[model samples]
Each structure stands twice: as C-alpha cells, then as structure tokens.
Target: MPRTPQPRTAVLASADLSFRTRVREALTGLRWEVQEAQGGAEALAYLEARPCEAMIVDTWLPDLEIQEFLAECEKRHPQTDLIAVDDPGPERGPERTQARSPRRNEVLLALRRGQDADHEPQGDGASWNGMPEMTPVHDRTVVREEIFVRGTAVVEATRPGAEPGPGTVRLPELIGEAPAMLEVSRRIRLVAPRAATVLVQGPTGSGKELVARAIHRLSPRANRRLVALNCAAIPDTLLEAELFGHTRGAFTGAVQGRIGRIEAADGGTLFLDEIGEMPLALQAKLLRFLETGEVQRIGDNDPIRVDVRIVAATHRSLAEMVKAGSFRADLYYRLAVFLIRTPGLGERPEDLPLLVERLLARMAEQAPVRRLSAEAMERLRQHAWPGNVRELQHVLERAAILAAESPEIGAAEIEFGETF
Candidate 1:
C-alpha cells in the first residue's frame, strides 16, 4: 500500500486579524494546519516549541525588529521554510527574501487570494474592509504595565493621540489612558473574538454603545451587519415584535411579514442597548433564543436557526433588579458571562483634555475647530460631569456655538447643564 502524507503545519504571524482571517480562509483545502501569532516574539516562541513546515511572517511585527527577527529565524530554524508577505504600501516591500520553499508557489498564491479578498466589496455593497489597516507595529515601543489581565500587553501611548502597538488591541473609538479605561480596552480585546455573551454595565452616557461597536468591529463577524436595538426606546407592546419576527397576520398590523433584529443580525452581532429595560416576560423568550440559537416567528411553527454574538449594555443595575424581583436571575447570569464596565468621566478626569480634543475635532467638520481658553478650560475642570461623556459633549457643542466666529472659546462661553 502507498504511504499517506501528513498535513503540513504553517505559522501565520500578524497583528491584523482581518489579514490572518483572509489567509486562513485561503488555505482551507490546502492540507495546511495554520497556527496564529500576534507578533514576532510569539511566532519565534511557537516555532521553538514545535517545528513547522513553513512560517509566513507579516510585513511588520509588533514586538521584535523585522530584519533582526528574519535573521534569527534563518540562523535558528534552518529546517523550516520562511515566507514573508509584501507590505501593504507600494513604496516599500519585505526587507529580505528567504530561500524558496517546496510549496512556495502554492503559499504565494494563497497570500494573493487573501490580499485580493481584503480589497473587494463586502456585504451590503459596502466597500469598507473588515478592519482599517493598522499602523505598523515597531519593535522599539515601550511596554506599559498591564492594566487588567496579567498576560495582556499594553504599549504605552507615545503621544496624546497614538495607535496601539502589537499584542495590544485598542479601538480608535475607545480613547483614554486611565487604568479603568485601559482595563475596559483589555477586556474588549479578550472577549470580542469569542462567541461569549458580553454584558457592558455602566452609568448612562458612559460610552456603552462604543464598547458594543468595538466588540462587533473586532469580532469574526465584522464583515456582516451589526444590528442594534435600544431595548428601552421602544414601547413594551411593540418591543416583542421588534425582537422576534412576526408573520404578516400575526398581530393587528398584519401589513407585512418581517424578521426581527435578532434574525437580521444573523452571522453578525446583535447589540441590545439598555437590556435591563426589557420586560421580564420578553426576557424569557430572549433567554430561550440565546440558549437554543433558534428563533421562532410570532405565528410560525417552524423555528429559524441563527448564528450571532450578543453584546448587551445596560445603565441600570441588573443585579439589584434581580434582587428586587424586577429582573430574571437566570437571564442575568447568561448575559453577564463576560462583564465590561465603561468608566464614567468623573472616574477618569485626566482623560478630559483628550476627550475635549477628540470631540472638538469631530465638531470641526461642521465649522472651524475652536480652541478653549485657559479660563474656559479651568471652568470645565471645575464643574462636575453628572451626565458623563455625553454631558461633556453637549457642553462642548454649546461652547463651540457660543464662541461663534471667535477662534477660541472663553470662560463666558462655557455652560453646565442641569443634573438629571
């Protein structure tokens, strides 16, 4: 009898999740078992532990110098073939080429397929790629102490506005340097890629939606739709229909048959905002869907299976509500599998300046960017932010309007909103 060949192992090293995903998909039927590494160091360590047939390194590595890393690999792991992906830009390419591998042509073909797929149109006719091209991770960056998990790496931000380095995943929307803020970033990176249900708890206007969006963007479902529903915004009578689909004649409207938010978010992320506001009766049905991954229409007997990640956010305390018999204990446990709390503005006062800069820059699209005078900044520092980041945004908007034609906002332009 003829001998059977074992599948070849390949190591993929890159900080870009989308790139890794595309490459992995391209190699699906190529008899290759691909292992992932977020940086050069991890790749080296992984190769040391287990010999592989080939290793494909990204153009840039987050932890180690690219040229140095390639040299080290050449010297230490001569038995393994090395292939490096081209840089995203046209001006520069991989620093050095490695000796040709037996399967170099096949691997290069797969890399081309992955690269082409990245630039092609995705779902909903949207040209947006899964993730923005991240700034290259340099080897000389300083490591900041872990803000939350022991193993998580957080590179210190070199400037006021800087991109996160290798092994650290920070969304551009999440802007803050406080320990609490960093902890939130750490937790998001940890849970975003998984199928786990995440419960984001925090005070009102503390950027819970931002956290939810971040989770969706970083997850495997990034290319799909991110369906969101504000549980508290809809009336109790219509909320059920909004969540679970209803047949044309299921209810009084009977105008048309339509799917609910859950079904719409199939193979994507379903963001339920203000989840605590959902009525207890409706919570039972939601729990069933979460448990079974099957949702039934209001008047239909057949249930539809869906694959989705749930990211629920709430301003109210579900634990307290459960204690008071207002929320279901079982549902609470299911949703709270991975808890992420967004920090209030008061908790991270040092981030106020950065927040102000970001908000002002956003507002600049409508009008000229206005600078805050020394006294105006002082006044902002003095007031207590009762409404959290939302209130700050409102205050800045008002000040920007009040400043009008002026290039800078003065103390008189600053105004505080009433506490709720």
Candidate 2:
C-alpha cells in the first residue's frame, strides 16, 4: 500500500465560541484538523507546541492587541498562513480582511459563512450545505469594498484616489468612518428635515454639541438663529429667567426686559446642553413650554408663543434619573421623541486613524502639520480612551507641542491623561 498523506492542521483562535464553531463547520468537508484557541496567547502557545498549516485570528483578543499579535505571528511563525476576521457584527464590514494563503477561497467562504450565521434570520428555512461561489479572479490587486447603510440607500465603497458616490452624505464636521459614526450621520439626515425633538445621549466629550449643530444646520430653520443654553452652566435661580426671559424689575439685577433663549430661537432651534442637570422644578416649566409652545417670562402676565425645535443633549441617563426621581418621566418622554446616541472612542477604535489624520490637519491651521509614526499610532490603539474624542484632540495637541521641531510625532511624544 502507498503511504497516506497527513491531514493539514488549522487553528481557529477567537474569544467567541460561535465564531469558531461556524468557521469549523464551514471547513468540515476539507482534509483538515481544526484546533480551537480562546485568545492570542493561547494560539501563540499552540503554534509553538505544534505546527499548523494555517491560523485564523479574530480582530479582537483578550490577551493581546490585534496588530501586536499579527506582528508576532509574522516574526515567529512565518510559515503559518494568517487570516484575521473583524467582529462579524452588522455594523462592521469586511474591509480589513487579509489572506496570504493559497486556500484563500476556502478562507473567504468560511468567513462569509460565519457572518451569515451571525445574521441568520429567525424561523426561516435556510441551508448552508452548498459551497459559496467565489468572486471571479480578474486581477491580483484587491479592491476595497465598503457598505454604508443609509435608509435603504447602499453606497458602494470608493476606491483609493476615487471620488465618493453622489448618494453618499458627506459630513465634513464629523471626522470618522466607523460604522457607529456612519449611523450617526444617517440618523441626522433622517431627523433633520422634520421638526421633531432630538435627544443626544453620550458620555462627556463624545461630541453631543457637535450633533446639535449638525441638526441645526440641516433643519428647515437653518436660515434662523440657533440659540444654545447650558442648563448645567447657569444657576437654578437664573436658568428659568435665562430660558423664558424676564421683565425689568422682575428680580434683583433684572436690568432690562430681554428675549430669552427660547424666544431668540423662534422659527429656529434651541439647544439645551446638559439637560440632565436641570432642576426638577425647571423641568416642569420646560415641559409645559414643550407641550404648549408657550413661554412665560418673570413679572409678565402674558405667555409668549414661540416656535422653536428643541434639541437637548446630556451625558447622564434621563431614564435612570427618572427612576431615581431626579428627572420627570413626562419631560423625559417629551424630550426623547427622537434619540441619537454618540458612541465613545473606545466603542469605535477602528476610526482612530482617520480621526488622527483629520485632527492633525485641523491643528495645522495654527501650527505646522505633524505626521504620526507607526509606533505612535500603535500606542494610541492600546489606550483605553476614557475621555473619548475630545481627549484625543487634547492628546494630539500636546504631542504636537512636544514634537517641537520634528515633523513627525513618535511614541515618546504620545502621552495619555490620567483616567478618573
């Protein structure tokens, strides 16, 4: 009898068991022995102990950064082909997928199968027994594919040095290409045309005010004034008057009758920042105004009618506050007619490169533009980013200053602030 060939061994490394199972099933019919590892450290250890023909790594790992792990794999086990899968979530597209294996079709098919399993609809007769058709091989160059979902509008990903499709909504103010940021832009477009109340919820420094400005700019009242009031900045004693205006001699320091923020924003929009910090008593007044579109000034008998769309933003959870009796339920419902949540920097780490580029370009307006070294970018990727995008801006500013005469910022110049 002739000698039999040994089965090629493959490793599936991920923190998600379902992802591993799906990929394993997809590769079942092939002549391969599949091994599972929970994280990068475990996978690395396995590769050292036993030789594998190929290894599939997840973009996120519990024990190591994806970039670091990939670099190590290249340096140590250069013979083993590597393929990394991004979070198979609906929000993220398969843009960063890279494969050097001759069995690239099998790898891509396995990836597609995993993604399909993730988005499998309930109670539908679907079969995964058939092999997926691979894209025709026209050239060695791989073109990027990006899907930006906006209200049933699918804009294909643009190639490098190519213009974006006309259907794409270009938001110059928002400097991120992450799925979370794309969703924010979609919501803005959907709600901007209407006069609905918008509640922007996010952690501090997550660009809530920027969302408000974008809404105002896109609204039908764009030609009119956009009046903003910081509910947390003004004292409770003066907030009511500042919001509803006050007649002369209404109270101490009431120099003259002035139009309040609401009145000033008539036919436009009124942005109330830190609305969660508003006093319960003032909440009642604000709710009444929202319900009737009327504002009653201090020492005034008549209630003035005002037509202003309300755009409120808060870092705190109004629902939790309502449960705690700090925020009124009725007012919360009124303000939260339409809600938009801004994701934290930690939630969308993939956008860091684009954000860094845009922020550095903006900083160039005041100073010479400085490029970030690969090591510096890797350092940024490892941070927790508890302060979100605002903190990123501050860090970059400090790094630029620290770089001094140098045109490029290095890892030594990148400093992170203490997280409370």
Q: Which stretches of candidate 2 lie over 4 Å from their true place?
A: 1-170
The digit string of per-residue lDDT tens for model 1 on 1-420 reads 998767778888876678888887777568788988765655766787799878888655443345556777887888787876753322365434445467766677778877775556756554332333432323222222212221123443121133433334444567777767867776766566567999999999999988887777556566577889999999999998998889999989868999999999999899999999999999999999999999998888999999989999999999999999999999999999999999889998988898888888879898997888989988888877879999999999999888889999999999895665
Error of 2 at 379 (Å): 0.7
How many pairs in model 2 have backbone atoms within 3 A of each other, for residues 3 or more apart or on separate chains, i.e. clashes?
A: 0
Q: Cα RMSD (Å) between model 2 and the true structure?
A: 20.6
Give per-residue CA lDDT, model 2, range 1-420, as digits (tens): 998756667888765567778888887656668887655555776787797878888654433346656767777788787776753432465533333566756766787787775544434433222212211213321111222221123222222233334433434356566767766765665566568999999999898888887777555465577789999999999999999999999999998988799999999899999999999999999999999999999999999998999999999999999999999999999999999999999998988998898789879999987999999999999998999999999999999999999999999999996778
- In angstroms, the error of model 2 at 20 is 56
Off by over 4 Å in 1: 11-169
